[model samples]
Target: MIIGKVIGNVWATRKEESLNGMKLMVVRRLDTESGCEQESFVAVDCVGAGIGERVLVTTGSSARMALDNPNKPVDATIVGIIDEVEVRAEG
Candidate 1:
């Protein structure tokens, strides 16, 4: 899973049939070591996450599974809304 911050939403009235009713949002990844915002990309949101909130994103095949639509063309999915994160430096 990747940690990201919800940046915005994607509204597409015309989309693939399999992607209908999906709530897509823009998420910016946070650097694992510094926890700073990185590149931003769109992702399907299954957890009703809103902008400015930190979220856990899953990618690849698992992303499709998160929505229970294995056949859907989902490369990324928001699986959880994160409350906090704590990373320890390597010993």
Candidate 2:
């Protein structure tokens, strides 16, 4: 799983039939330790995540599982909207 922030939306009028109803968003990867934003990528939204919200993303085969469809042709999917993130310093 990857922690990211929804930065924007993706509008594809012509896409695969299986992805017709899927909401796609651009999610910028977040560095848990430094709170830095990294590269962004499009991900299918399964949890109704909106722009600016922090989200949890699943990728690869697991991403397909999040949608409950293995043939959705998606490499990434937003599985959860994050409420908060707390990182503690290891002693």
Candidate 3:
């Protein structure tokens, strides 16, 4: 899973038949604590995440599996909305 923030949304009137009813969002991956930039990618919002919301994104085959619908035609899917993150760093 990837922790990221929703930066924007996407709209397409005409899309692939398998992607008919999916909500799309632009997500930028973040660092563990500082929230530094990592990468950005478009993802399907399965959890109804909005802009500025911190979300949990699943990528690749795991994403497709999360949907439990093999024909969804999604490469990435937002699985959860993160409220907080706890990390322990050892030097």
What lDDT does candidate 1 reach at residue 19?
Answer: 89
Clashing pairs in 2: none
Stretches > 4 Å off in candidate 2: none
lDDT of 3: 0.89
User: How far is 71's C-alpha from truth in model 1 (Å)?
Assistant: 0.8
Deviation in angstroms for 78 in model 1?
A: 0.3
Instruction: Say which prediction, candidate 1 or candidate 2, comes out ahead on lDDT.
Output: 2
- 1 versus 2: better TM-score goes to: 2
Model 1, position 13: C-alpha lDDT score: 89
Q: Candidate 1: where are CA atoms >4 Å away?
A: none
**Per-residue lDDT for 28-82 in model 2, tens only?**
9999788898999999999888889999999998899987678879999999999
User: Candidate 2 has what TM-score?
Assistant: 0.93
Candidate 2: residue 16 Cα off by (Å): 1.0
Ranked candidates, highest lDDT first: 2, 1, 3
1-91 in candidate 1: lDDT tens per residue? 9999999988998889898988989999998668878899999999989999999999988888887758889999999999878777672
